[model samples]
Target: MSGRVSHTVDMSVKLGELTLRTPVLTASGTFASGREFADFIDLERLGAVVTKGVSLEPWEGSPSPRIAETPSGMLNSIGLQNPGVEAFCEDDLAWLSSVDVPVIVNVSGHTVLEYVSVIERLEVEPRVDAYEINISCPNVDSGGMAFGTACTPAEEVTRACRAATSRPLIVKLSPNVTDIAEIARAVVASGADGVSLINTLLGMAIDIRTFRPKLARIVGGLSGPAIKPVALRMVWQVAGAVDVPVIGMGGITDTEDAVEFMLAGATAISVGTANFVDPTTVMRVTDGLAEFCRTRSIARVSNLTGAMRT
Candidate 1:
């Protein structure tokens, strides 16, 4: 174990031979709030950026008062509110071009045809580095539960999208599944190059006095430090079950948390909820990892990935 640990990793690891500079990336949705913070963190600094989930049609999203704070984490039902793909490309793609990072476009759809149509439009575009299909979005009531979090449509959705795009395809799995490893293996078998796990866990909160739901939507995806353990466990199981790389997320607030996931077998780590707490987390964590390797004389951060053994 120490022998492998001492070997330098070069900060570049292959996800089926496609190399990434660093394993630290901003989780989709968290890093997808337009380009306001793009200037704060050099977009080029990230391994890859998966934008927020964009729908075919502009969705008003869930009712207002969409968030609530939990002890170790926060609950949100932001819905996949976006300006639609056409608007996103027109206005947002410009900033994307300004950034030198690989933009992994995230697509959300209610049905098979819807998914195909969106990808088809993006397929012709130039700035996209990859596609992260979010199958476990629990906010919207309609297609929110449609594409994923279940076995039936999970494999079907992955197979359909794989046939549609020639670029690298990553299926974002939902922790809501009964046995997440089952779905992870299925995604790899269905032609997905990699998988991102534990898309927010499904949860709810209730107001004490009114005896009503705390949030207007009544339910939302739970994220933050609270879900870290769950995310780590799922990533561990899935990484062992599948051949493809695993991008781990959930309550990752710092470099240590990111290291935990890597040790658990995650090829990459995404900073999600932590972004809300501190917007500069992307650069902070990335720099911290670099420092970590430098101080420890560990040469490459990728060497930390999957360092655990049974």
Candidate 2:
């Protein structure tokens, strides 16, 4: 047997100026408020927990048949369902605050005022470590254009959200745009602390027998291993263009996939759809990351960011 030193590898990472103990984190909406996977994995083992989209008021969500399975991915149009901010703070935050990990609240809205209102309400809460502005939601104020699809609206929304809170603000960008790098630059200039990208590609599916769309919404956000290449391409481009830390995500299911994103320039990664396949995914990723570092003799995991060669 070969003797390899059983040395400890450093896994801490920084998203902008926010230091995370590990680079592994759960994607918003997929992880909920940490209650769902508490029995399967320890919450503190991961870097952070990104809670589901929280709006100013309750959301009933979309109609039935909201999910459809594709060849290697899935489509979902859940419509940002969540209990209002008040209820979230009373129930979700109360429990999350007791946990050891940092909490990143994902805030969504149909209008600028709505987004600002939610931030104002949560700004003073000590349990909230950071805010992830969800600009992918359709803007009711802009005739249904997604704020993340345009640089102007993206900048406007980011500016409003940034002004409302002092905590580190991360803008989640939509892939359905002409130039993602331009949008990333716009938001960053408007005071975004960091950026997370390739939030599901817009896609759809139809049932051959029924002659109807698989999902009630007809079109939905597509996610899984199938989109890995697109996600990686976008992450690499944005990481090269932007100065702030980039949180890369979209179709990450294992440790190798996580490492690819880091090498592409992601300071951290959020595991999405995979959480549904395995509740213990976060625990496995965090441990597996350390193993990869140990085996490869990597002194610190942070060194992997932007290590890609030309």
Candidate with the greatest lDDT versus the true structure: 2
lDDT of 1: 0.82
Candidate 1, clashing residue pairs? 224-251
**Could you tell me the lDDT of residue 166 within candidate 2?**
82
Over 24-120, each residue of candidate 2 has an lDDT whose tens digit, in order, gives 9888889899898998888987899999989899987878798899988999888888999999999999999779999999998888898999999
Off by over 4 Å in 2: 1-7, 138-145
Off by over 4 Å in 1: 1-9
Could you tell me the lDDT of residue 22 within candidate 1? 73
Q: What is the C-alpha lDDT of each candidate?
A: 0.82, 0.87
Tens-digit lDDT track of model 1 for 1-310? 1222223545555555457767877888887743867667666667877788877778777897889899899999989888888888887776787767777888898787777778888888888778888888998765655667676688898899889988889899988878999888887888899999889988999989999887898989899999999999999999889888899999999988888899899988889999888888877777667767767887777778888877
For all predicted structures, in order, the TM-scores are: 0.93, 0.95
